[model samples]
Target chain A: MELRQFCSQSRVVIVAGKGGVGKTTVTAALALAATRAGLSALICEVEGKSGLAAAFGSDALEYDELHLDDRLTARTLAPDDAMVDYLESHGMKRFSHRLAKSGALDVVATAVPGMKDILVLGKIKSLEQLPAADLIVVDAPAAGHAITFLLAAQGLLDAIRVGPIRKQATEVVEMLTDATRCQVMLVTLPEETPVNELIETAFAVEDRAGVALGPVVVNGCMAPLRDQPDSITSLMAAGFSLTTSTQAIEAVAFRSSRHAMQEIQIARLAEQLPLPQIHLPQLLTAAIGRAELNKLADAMAHQIELLQ
Target chain B: MTAFANLATTREIIVCCGTGGVGKTTTAAVLAIEAARRGRRAVVVTIDPAKRLADALGLDALSDEPKLIDQQTWNIFDRDPARSGLAQGTLSALMLDTKSTFDKLVHEHAPDEPAADRILDNRFYRNISGALGGTQEYMAMEKLHELHTSGEFDLIVIDTPPSRHALDFLDAPERLMRLLDNRMFRLLMMPTKTYLKLAGAALQALLRTVSRVVGREVVDDAIAFFQAFEGMEQGFRDRAAKVQELIDDPATAFVLVTTPRRDAVDEATYFAQRLESNGLQVAGLIVNRIHPEFGSESPESLRALAHGNAAILNLADFREIAIRERETLETLTARIPSDAVGYVPLLDEDVHNIATLATVATHLF
Candidate 1:
């Protein structure tokens, strides 16, 4: 219902956005929030993406989940590894090893569309089913693919009417569509492209999977530097020279215009996205690491409270 | 050091790539449009689903075929078009549709109609063609190859899929080769040969036993797919090799597009290494959406220069961003060693139309 409540209650929380829109950062922030809220969280990603690893500031992740802190574990999930685990869970451990060795797992991951996604989802679902983890936050693929991923099971179920694969698809679909079980959050930047794409993706997710679309997390928002009670133009007219300090005037002008543009886009995002939204202020640090993620988590908590 | 830095007259195949969300699509579009304004026929191939490319080009849609832009919009851009060494060029763009391109490839490359129908009609192809790993990247190259070989344009620009690693597009051909040449792959195809019937029987039996473990339908789907693709495998292999050659050609160049963010810079450096390691050419680097570099002096000096002029100088916010971004970009540029590095100031608004793209192209060219 509420932002913090949804973060705590949902079995699986997926964060999605366009490429380079800071989806991984938002996912890590959510994971941190979930951990802080006392919900043991497992942050999942499609393996080989170092974004999550960079966000968490740890390279220890592999098939086994690395415990980052109390109640928080992060792991990168690969389709191939998920296939191996799927086979092993299906009681074909030796077969999986042989398949992996022969590189058939690559074939499976490469050739099959929904198969790869299903395997990854199956793994996430398994982790979600675990009693040890209260919530699972999946850092999903960028917009187009993320929607395809969430609807992969439904696509298969629609295509294959009667089969074991269909049955598996049904279960994944159930988990995804159930509001109490899942919430898909669309992370965005207060920019035109990402916000527009997020709107399209939100509608597509609802149309295709009927999943509960969580609040929009607007990352990289530039808030006002300080409340300037008066305009610089007035001061310039009040006696400030324009030509000598052209660089400063230009930089200040650029910053003010950019901040003004962000506000317009933010308003556009609010009017366009049907779901609730939380704005995460832009980070000024040169690098993004755990400290930035924790700071974002704290900011996210404040926004959650504000929205409530 | 940048071979194709002067993209205006380079007259080469420019492939824009970098980590996702760093503006490859827009860069590719801008370059193509710049080429067009310079009087060459240029086409931009983009796989990004955002449709920003379409908007930037002032078009409602960009399909596989190169559609002419609205004359009114072109006229507006054409007014001061030659202001920046621009030629009287023409531009058109193609947004990639991998599924449609696959269908076209099937139509042209497949042995016969029924053979094409067999692969096309297969349920697996219906569901998986678009989603198949590397298909988008592979097909983008395939389409690029088709366009490059054609005598259509003076310049061709390709925007790669916004993958985490831009190398995925470059590696797609080799990876596709591996998938086709894998040991299990040959074993799976054994059943198609008449002379290998006995071995096929053995392998097929083992497959059935394996099928029971995973699922009959999935394994059967794989079997059916391989059977349908048997005739076309060689064609795919040949084209993949051709694309590999095309990428490594001297007339083709790769442009790394990135923002000034630390992650973008890190990935750009890593991407540069991957390109160099693979023996591909790095034409230049275009750092997109960077905060405007304030002044030639330090931020403190720049702020101090504003004495007596303002009650409040908001230069700190922008000055801080500008400095951090410059440092981050310097870290990447130092590693790249490409003198052709160009920085496009972060626009007040997103580059939405051809006019805005024209302004960006000024910085790039």
Candidate 2:
């Protein structure tokens, strides 16, 4: 279950989390890890959160892939853009033009309910179908919508029972259902609401789509309290004589509480799932780049080893 | 003049709205903190069901009513001597529980207990009220209107629910009115009990068939839920219309909040466009977690020094910091209108209390 082993087995790996939990950063890091391992990987982002582009040091990304390194590439899927491309590819250029002229593209796109989700999923499926790539890492929409997108094929299949749509929907469902082909990772912070939602989302996914539940990545985990209890007691005993010293002790105590909460939640989740759990330490700084990503990759790689 | 400074002069209410997890809570907190620091008594009310305001303000707990952060009490300003510069104007926060707010709205609108009970006791009312995205949004507006009418604060900042249905809250009043006004629905349910009596046998038969198919009592529960809401459409709709009018008013300003990330910005942009199309005034945009620029040394030099071959390094250790900062700034400048955009730098710690919120306020204002 090393990082390479997982990527080698799964064609489509979805990274999902609550917003601001650094799904995009983790997606980029995992993609970079895959590339570093000598696998050709395309990091696809659906949220239009050019986080992948930023992580790869690119100003912008188009529907077409931008090479970040020899084996790693990144692209963003804009639903409207993907729809137009999809229409053109299917030789429905006239219909596409007519829809554009009618100014009904937006209406049609949204009115169909799960249409955007379908297009986004369709695009990810297309990337997964690419011949050269060993893996396609999707930085999906936030947890809720991502789940909706993952289940869109089934939803459409149930809602529309006949025709080419049913056939396409069936294909999408098959792709998602096969664990060896597709896997979903729930990314979460070590907190009450996120952890609660993560567990709920896992159950929901299991019930609805029967998609394989991959490991959960708890992002922004704080380091364990390094200073001894005696030292802390001594500092407290020393009184609030110095503001800096007092603040230091309080900060450590606060950090410990946050970290402990995260660990407890992670353990609870691990007890429920058969999958490995990876803990990514909170960085001292807010901005994460290649350096922080590599450290996360190393941590993930270690988790993968444990899984094996 | 700052973008927000201009907004402050014109807008009455600033609604910071977005999907969940996009920093909508933090954005609202920072905006209120900034306004208060600028000598205005600003109140931030969050309608997100999951309470994060206390966490964002670094407080252990928050109440349904506005709570002043004790930390801000230490600062004093001489220029606004009428108000203690140190205490200045106060920044207050509260969390709006949507379901409770909706119930309160029902109680306010109904003429008597019997009438209110009739509506509340309806099964349809309970199920749809909680499940409908529009209901949550509308309740949020109702809460906003309550705060606006109070006149206790100069500015009221609201953190809207995280959903596209957030607009439904603004649009709820109209939808509710439409539903109430529907002659067809009323006509069908006119002999409510008689209709229930006649349909009960058929519904039972259908439920039995459904139970056989699904191996569950889902249909029976659903039927019971609908039967309960039979005669209360008008009361609910009338209140909904009133709430809708409050949201559509020109006095309210919608502030779209997003992170510097592309997906968030795009969603915010889409929301702003939708608000504008619906004739809702967009006060501005608050882009959070912007990468702060480091001095002098370029990304290229750092990249060259670190080299592509390096295995483990933090972003701060190499030129990726400069690169990311530049790219983020460029994206912000290109996508967000300069006049309506406010940037909050990335902080080392999560913004969970008054001091950090004040720090965020300084950056934003």
- Models 1 onward score TM values of 0.90, 0.59
Index of the highest-TM-score prediction: 1
- lDDT of model 1 at position B8: 48
Query: Where is model 1 chain B poorest over a 10-residue stretch in terms of lDDT?
Result: B308-317
Q: Which residues of candidate 2, in runs, are more than 4 Å off?
A: A1-16, A22-186, A189-215, A219-303, A306-308, B5-10, B19-22, B37-41, B58-60, B65-88, B163-168, B175-187, B192-238, B295-335
Instruction: Give the interface-residue alpha carbon RMSD of model 2.
Output: 11.8
Query: Residue by residue across B237-278, what tens digits does model 1's lDDT show?
Result: 888889999888888878899999988888888888889999
Docking quality (DockQ) of candidate 2: 0.07
Q: Write the per-residue lDDT of candidate 2 for residues B89-176, one digit (tens) a residue.
A: 6778887766677677677766777767766765445534554436666667777777777788888888876755566665667654
Q: What level of docking quality does candidate 1 show?
A: acceptable
How much is the lDDT of residue B298 in candidate 1?
A: 53
Global lDDT scores for all candidate models: 0.75, 0.64
